[model samples]
Target: MNRTARLYALVEELRAAAPRPLTVARLAARFEVATRTVQRDLQALMAAGLPVRAATGRGGGWSIDPRTTLPPVRFTAQEAAALTVALAATDHGAPYAAAARTAAQKLAAVLPAATAATARDLAHRAAVEHALATGTVLRLHYADAAGRSSERLVEPAGLLTAGGHWYLIAWCRTRRAGRGFRLDRITGADPTPEPAGPHDLAALLRGSAAAGARPPAALAALDELTAPGELDEHRTTGT
Candidate 1:
C-alpha cells in the first residue's frame, strides 16, 4: 500500500486495538512494512493533527482516542471514480494543489479495499497532469509521431485526454506555436521553477475543433475509461 493509504490503515488498526497499545513490532508485522517505516508514518499522522498517542517504555505501543475520529461512510463505485477524478482536477490550476491530492488519498483510505484500489488507480492520472500544472517551463524528453526523440523546453498551455491517452498541449518554444505531446511518449518531464511566459490555450483547442480531432474511435476509448462500475468489477472481480 502507498504511504497515504497506509497511514489511514494504521489509524484504523490502532483504533481497533484501542485501550491497548500495539507494539511497533506488531504494527510493522500487520502492515507488512519495516518497523522504522511505521515510526515515520506515525510521525506523519501526528503532524497532520491526528490524535495519535505513542506509549513509551517496554510493552508500550500506539493508540488513538476513539472520540477524535469520525465514523465511516460508504461510497459507491461511481462516486469514488468521480471524487478521484475531481480531486485530480483540483491538483491542476487550483490554489489547493497539494491539499487536493492529500484529500484524494484520505478519501481513498476510508473506502472499501476494492473501491480504494480502483480509486487510487484512477487518481494516478494526476501524475501526468501535475507536470503541466506547475505554471512554469518544463524540460521534456519526448518522442514524436514517427518515434524520433528530442529534448525541448515547453510552456504548458493545457492538457486533454482521449483514446485512453493524455496529451500535453503546450507552446513549443522551438516551433513558436502550439503542439500536442502525448504523455506516454514523453519519456521524461521536469518542471522548472522559471515561470512560463503567457501563452493561449485557445490556439490549440481551435485547431482541434476544426479537425474534429477526438474522433469516434477516441471517444469510444474515453467511454470505456470512465464507464461506471466497469472499473470496479474489473479490478475487484477480474471479470
Candidate 2:
C-alpha cells in the first residue's frame, strides 16, 4: 500500500493493539515493510501533529492514544463520493488545505477502492487559497467571452459567487483597472510573492464592467432544460 494509505492503516493497527504496545519489529512485520520504513512512517505521523507515542518497556512498541485519536468510521460509497467532491471543489479556496487533504486521505483509507482512487484524484489545490489569504499578487492566464487570451498580473483582491459561479475580483495590471476573471475561464494562475496592495471587493464589483459579464455556473441554467413539456418529446413510444 502507498504511504498515505499505510499511515491510516498504521493508526488503525495501533489503535486496535492499544492498551498493549506493539514494537517496531512487530509493526514492520504487520505492514510488510522494513523496520526503518516503519520508523519513518511513524515519524511522519508524529510530524503531522498526531500523538503517536513510543512506549519503552516490555510489551512496548508504538501506538496512537485512543483519547487523542478518533475511532474507525464506516462510510458508504455514496457518502464518500459526496464528501470527496465537496472537499475537492472547496479546497480550491479553503484555508488549512493540508489538513483537509489529510482528512480526505484518512477517510479514503478505510473506504472502498473506488473511493480511495477518487480521493487521490482530487488531492491538492492549496495554492489559490494560500495566495488569497496572504494577499499575494498572481499571474493569471485568462480568456474573455470571445475566447481572446492574455496573461495578466493582478493583485489578489476578493472572490464573488453569484448564481453559483466564482469570479476573481482583482486589479489587473494589464487593464490598468479592476476586472473580474471568471474562475472557469482562467486557464492558469501562478501566485507571486510580491505583496498585493489593498483592493476592496466592493469597489472592484462596482467598477469592473467585466464583472457584470461573467457567466453563471453551467448548471445555473438547469431550469431551461427542465421547462414544461420538454421531457415529453423524448418519451418512449407505444406507451
Candidate 3:
C-alpha cells in the first residue's frame, strides 16, 4: 500500500479499534509518523465530516463518533474511466502511483463490455495531457495562488476530462464551495468520506444562462446524438 492508501487504512483501523477519543501521539504511534503529521491528518478528517474530536492538553487525541456511518463507494464505468485517465496523468511517480494503478486495474476488471471498450479506446488514443494529482487528500496546510489559507475535506467526485486536461469536482467543506480544484495544484490529498452537502451546478446557479436561447455552435451539435436511452437524458439536461 502506498502512503495515501496506508493513511486511509490506518484511519479506518483506528476508527474501528478505539473505544474513546484518540490523541495525536497515539495516532502518530499507530502510523509511526511525527505528531505534527497526525494533527494535520486529524484536521483533514474533521473537515471531511468524520465526526472527529480533539481534546486539548497532554491527553488530547483524535476520536470519531461511534454513531457516524461510513461513506458509500460506487462508480459507473465512465466514472472509473475518468479516474483512470486522471491517475495516469499525474506525475510519473507520485505517492499514489501504486494505488491509482491498482485501482485502474480493478476498474478494468469490473467495467461492462461496451463501456470498457470505449474506455480502452480513449486511453490508448489519447494521452494524459496534464500531469497533476497532488495526493488523495490534500495535506491541509497549503495556500492557494490567491494567498488564501484553507483546509478542505473533499470527496473525490467524478474526474472530468475536457480540453485534454483532468479536473476533480468534489464537495469541499472548508470553503463551503463545490469547486473544480486543479489536481496539479493539490500539494497532497488523502481519501476521506464524502461531505453531506454536494456541489451541484444546476442547484448552484439556478438557471443562469437563460433557457431556450440558441446555444453556441459548439453545443448545438450535441442534439444529433440524443437518440435514446441515457443519452437522451444528457440532452434534456442541456449537456
Best by TM-score: 2
* Model 3 alpha-carbon miss at residue 67, Å: 2.5
Please give the ranking of all candidate structures by TM-score, highest first, separated by commas.
Answer: 2, 1, 3
Candidate lDDT values, in order: 0.64, 0.63, 0.47
| Model 2, TM vs. native | 0.47
- Per-residue lDDT value at 176 in model 3: 53
Give lDDT tens digits, candidate 1, residues 1-239.
98767887898898889879988899999999999999999988887767898989987889899897875556776797668656744533468777776667666566778776655544443444554556777777777666678887778766655456666667777766666776666665544557787776554444232122242331222222222221111111101
Give one digit per residue, the lDDT tens place, for model 3 in 31-109: 7888887777677656645567776776555666666645435777679777755653444346776666555654554
**Which residue runs does candidate 1 get wrong by more than 4 Å?**
1-10, 24-53, 65-68, 91-97, 106-166, 173-177, 183-239
Q: Once superposed on the true structure, which residue ranges of model 3 sit more than 4 Å away at CA? A: 57-59, 71-239
Alpha-carbon RMSD of each model: 11.0, 12.1, 16.6
Native-to-model Cα distance after best TM-score fit, residue 34 in candidate 2, in Å: 0.6
What TM-score goes with each of the models?
A: 0.46, 0.47, 0.33
In lDDT terms, how accurate is model 3?
Answer: 0.47
Error (Å) of candidate 2 at residue 150 is 17
Clashing pairs in 1: none
The count of residue-pair clashes in candidate 1 stands at 0
Of models 2 and 3, which has the larger TM-score? 2
